[model samples]
Target chain A: MEKENIRYSELERLCKEFRKTILKIITEAGSGHPGGSLSVVEILTTLYYLHLNHNPKNPFDDKRDRVVLSKGHSCPALYVILAELGYFDKQELHNLRKVNSILQGHPARVYNGGDEVKFVPGIEVSTGSLGYGLSVAVGMALGFKMDNKQNLVFAICSDGEHQEGSIWEAIMFAGFKQLDNLIEIVDYNKLQQESRIDDSVSLEPLKEKYISFNWQVYEVDGHKISELDTALADAKKYKGKPKVIIAHTVKGKGVSFMENNVDWHGKAPSKELLEQALKELEGK
Target chain B: MVTVLEYKPSREGLGEALLEIADQYPQLVAIGADTANSTSLGKFAKKYPERFVNVGIAEQNAVGIAVGLSLVGKLPVVSTYAMFLAGRCWEEIRQSVCYNYSNVKLVGTHAGLTVGPDGASHQILEDIALMRVLPNMSVIVPSDANEAKVAVKKSLEKVGAVYIRLSREKLPVFTSPEEDFVIGKAKLLREGSDCGIISCGVMVYESLVAAEILEKQGINCRVINMHTVKPIDTEAIINTAKKCKCIVTCEEHQVYGGLGSAVAEVVIKNYPVPQRFVGIKDKFGESGPAEGLMLKYGLKAQHIVETVKEVIKYK
Candidate 1:
């Protein structure tokens, strides 16, 4: 019921609140990737809640579409989304990366609910080593296509991760297969963990590269819920080519000091910074 | 259990069996690199055209795609030569498939020196050792068409990542299709007391023939087929060691970390016995015909018979 356009005004509000949640969770835990997590909240919120024909009750229902988080370092956003969908208790969000907790520093395969206490549902493959998820998603799309099952596969990749060879392999492969079902969303947060992505290794002419790979490439503001939704919807409408949405997102969008700063990439917010971030996002 | 009457390349067996698997189990799929015909996965391609992936000479892509299929719950059979699947794409196998512990079957054909005329490049004698080293990998090297057929059936049930290293040459049939071919359990072909000869893949036939020769010489030797090498059937090897007090291991692979090494590792862990390895040594095999290499590299039945006598003397 939470369609993208209907929640336009509320989208910004939800994003701000989600940013607060990420910061609070990370700061309480003393370690997390706040920058990319805050940046990806709107996209994650849109995909998990609005779209994705997956059951919160029966997670392993084979027909469900898949989501592969290529940039797994930003698991703060991923785990937040998983918790939002009632994968586990919201109270359990605070126990991330602690001893014996399902949530590790990186997302791992964990069972959800009782009876079907199996598989790492919600997460297709535990891909902490970046750049591998796209190929894996492509494999999934091909499998579904083979089975004649109408399922969409959404692979979330970071702009920084474009440097990896595995991603290009997936791109070439998807293009060859002409798999219109697979969707690749680029969280184009300019900052990498070390430096700005462009400064480190310029993925310039990125659109041209994808277009050369025969992908139906689209560009959008990752945080603009309306544009993100339209891009994803339009992707589904287009036929005969795999789609890639280059979402231009600021690194750590909602928070003040964290935005556009490379230092905030993998570093969690401090106590003072967390309060400040919350105040900025959740203003009464 | 589907009955396969004719003896064909297990890759050919896959070529015939894959589409059936695809039709029967919606989860069954394949990824190949233009080697479908060579690997005998073409029948699978024709039946379920959409289900088969042709990565176009990219072995790494083929492997990566298999990993992806595993994540999405499709049991993918990667069709490639043993040389490329385990040799060229070793990193992909390590990082993607085995690292994640996916339910994938890497169908590696053209294994061992028997892939003659194609020269040493196509021959993959080291694949068994390479695959056996990886944890969570079930290494199944079927002896003949019957065993290969059984392996094809059993690999589907075997858990985690599996590597089915098949011979390129069309081998003679020995076992009945109705026989039980469990992945880790070795099959005892001949029961004898004087000495025990354990072998896998194409070499099992040689061991059996050698056992016959040993019988003529009044040396009643035992021949056991150690198909699944990674989870070496230690009980079988130890029993053979206890029964004969000496062991002669045979394989088309290197003596190190292969079927022989795997059995040796197990036997040495439990009880040390006078063991003889009839396999390729540290040197690379030269370009020759199938029979020539087997004869030249001490891989023949006569070699096994001779080794059994030597091992018996030591025992």
Candidate 2:
């Protein structure tokens, strides 16, 4: 794989911009998941701007690599990058959860009369209910392998989503089938919506769990753009087994008060809180 | 005396249909949730080994994968026992497949009371109700083996989600192999004026037999095969209500949300008519022979005949 021409400084700058925009939208919408959105800023920024082989013009091109945001509540982050990359009009971002908006609260395709009329261009599948997106990604990878295509499928799941039994079910199938084309990146922010993973249901042996299921595991600092870029590039080349990058990140990365806080997991910031959060992100 | 018909499980027709249409639809793929042979998807797996995927007892993953495969231009057919496929993975089917409008075919074998000896745990009496409720999901319960084959093949021709319910028991094969399957088009097997018998799945055979017995008793009954539960043949249902003025719904499922409720919805709205239902009256099925269970659940020909007489009095 060729190196992405963008420098680490440029990627870091975009992460700050993404964090501010994510908080602003959540505040405007009056309800959205901000903690998980802030957690995966660098990971998504690196993938969309640097790593993924996608075109904003031909979003559904057959040769393009696919991405499934399994932890869909953090879609404010995804929506920002997609709009910046011209997947849809940037103005549509304001109508995030409003009725008749194409941007659903979760990642989804708009369907009318049982027909898909419109959808956010970059979103590969409609997902909100956890534990199902990995299976969908595995299916896509298997389909690509069947057709002898080289396109890869990336599935981004939250650490809390690993609690779903279907995630392991998909992992088992991907490993058994030797789907080297499927890469799963877990946003390991430690905290779920109500509490931390340690206080609630603990997924302590998470790394060994994937290895036992025949997956090649890689752990990295999720906020580090270069590390995520490296792991993503290597996972793309690794063969004979599925790959999962456990991305360690804070609940809210740039925001001072919201960082590591469980209450920010799904709550939108008020205007006063939003201004303070944006001030914290201004120079970072 | 009614002649004994050749018996064949509806799952067999599903297998035959896959083989029949495999060459034409080269992108056709079969996915099984560890019950490949039981659901008769083994036939497709045997011939097209590369195209077959056994997800290994994970019904939710099977549905999610089927949706994924559909997104990438493959016609993925996923089958498992009805209880697991429809009951366990209902939300997956709704969100990934139907709500996404993925072109996936879901085949639920061992449906209704015909899945004998497994008891209520394995038999799915609520699949029709469960599947029919989802938007963009077309639910089809074939009357016999031949119609099951047509339903499977025809369902693939369209570009949306479809749920085909098949029975595990070796049922009497009465539907013709030559008949064309049009979705939402009910087949009126016998025309009569005394009363109408609307039925689906294995109970269609029972309804036909019941109509025969009613004819001998000078009470002619109209027997209809209401195969497609969703996108129901409302015209057939309304016309039957007008012609007969009385209706009796027969099904090998719970009387609540299966063919009985569907027919009643159409009848009571379009043309109000007196109707009676012949099915399991909200009870779990116990372990027994298929024939014995049908008798105990009041889903046999005799039960349909009795229900028809009961509804005619209300007319």
Candidate 3:
């Protein structure tokens, strides 16, 4: 197989593994946003495995590409990826959201116990607040541009986060500056906590909304590896404007009961549900 | 290294210093609303075109971008009008900048009633109160052009979130060009022994004027520039109280959490002294000339003199 072809399947495998890991950690923690985490697993996996130029050991590598988590509530997904990427020991995954663990309700800049690390490299900023990731992404992109580095800044926000006027302000500013090196991934999970996004606040004409703001919009099935790669490739093709990948995805992707459900927004799986989820994931 | 003649607004000093810092460090980028001209960031925008980000009238967005840049190991200087940066986008300033401990320098221009014609809506009276209350946020109010330049540079070099309140009006230079402006240290412009007058922003100059009148009246008041409100110089306040016996604080903000309250908190805790506050008396100001507003609100050198006399009577 060609190098690109070999790398593609490797990333696909990583995505599946990441999905299983996210489910395990969230089920153990007993309180997390699983649906959103599962929805963006492919985007996170692809960025970690292929797209972003980052080193697992030297997390703060000066030239490493930055990834901002705008939808911070859905951190179980990114936490799994960072662990797989070697930010910390995989053993720490089970200790997540426990008292005194570095991993808290939301991702924070806490001192990890084993590594003598104050802030892990792969984890860029401590975040959980909504409608903020894109702005930080713009800041990082502008910083790289200022330093004449060619690395791109990727941010993962949510459809609900788009309802924020601040998010649009960042979008327009990123568009106005023509920051081609910036890429934003909006996980259109269709459901926010307690309500469907359309019923809550319509983000309709979403793709056109981004296109009008001068962002190159790329819509794709966020779970499919091929679609994920193609969308990212297309975003990179545009060299003079920022790009937004509107990945249409189900809320909870893998497990049956949690799939496409708003109840899984921050509700952890029950002990019985956890056993069932682990059985299905392990069977795969 | 451009030299200036006569008086210049503190915001102009900030604009020039920022461009110099951006030139010195490639990572220093400035984000703003549509007020680049009013904030005087247009020069920085022109000089380092790649580093300037105009977020068009969105204060919340501007703060968010600054945090993102800091996470990527880049120093970001976010510029916006005082009213919006503190009043409108304060939550972003809190979460993104302070809570995250991002190395984001927030340059708040047109602070106080001195913003003048922009009216009460544009003027920010609660900024000092807001900034002083935030954790890990170093709040600075530079007294003059030289001090503004020094404070702006200091905020960029410091390793945490910082807020530098810039004045819109032109004022006489308080600090000499060669004087060092340390973070959290109070600058004593004049030394006396009856009453200690602590002030910040253009009001520092006002306090200096108040000192001269007090000296002639045998009041012998000591004036200290308490510029950095948070991590406030408690040691200096104690030192002033020990020497001067009484204290009076004057600022272009409410008497409630502005410079007065900041000083009073330190004095009451460390040294017991009679403290008089000369500021906006917990009221929203009306639209008028800046000078008229200062007099009406009792935020001037004369007000400081009267407060000093009143505190002296109590002593």
Best of the candidates, lDDT: 2
Per TM-score, what order, best first?
A: 2, 3, 1
Instruction: Between candidates 2 and 3, name the one with more favorable TM-score.
Output: 2
In candidate 1, stretches whose alpha carbon ends up further than 4 angstroms from where it belongs are A1-6, A23-35, A110-117, A191-196, A199-201, A252-284, B1-10, B19-23, B67-74, B88-102, B117-121, B133-136, B157-160, B283-286, B305-314
- Model 1 - which docking category? acceptable
DockQ of each: 0.38, 0.82, 0.57
Higher-lDDT candidate of 1 and 3: 3
**Error at A122, model 1, angstroms:** 1.7
For residues B134-165, could you state the per-residue lDDT of candidate 2 as single tens digits? 98899999988899999999999988999999
- Clashing pairs for model 1 are none
Give the per-residue Cα lDDT of candidate 3 at A229. Answer: 81
TM-score of candidate 1 chain A against the true chain A: 0.93
Considering only chain B, report the TM-score of each candidate against the true chain B: 0.95, 0.98, 0.96
Q: Candidate 3, which CAPRI tier? A: medium
Model 3 regions lying over 4 Å from their true place: A1-17, A109-117, B1-7, B19-23
Per-model root-mean-square deviation over C-alphas: 4.2, 1.8, 3.5
lDDT of each: 0.82, 0.90, 0.83
Best by TM-score: 2
Query: How high is each candidate's TM-score?
Result: 0.87, 0.97, 0.91
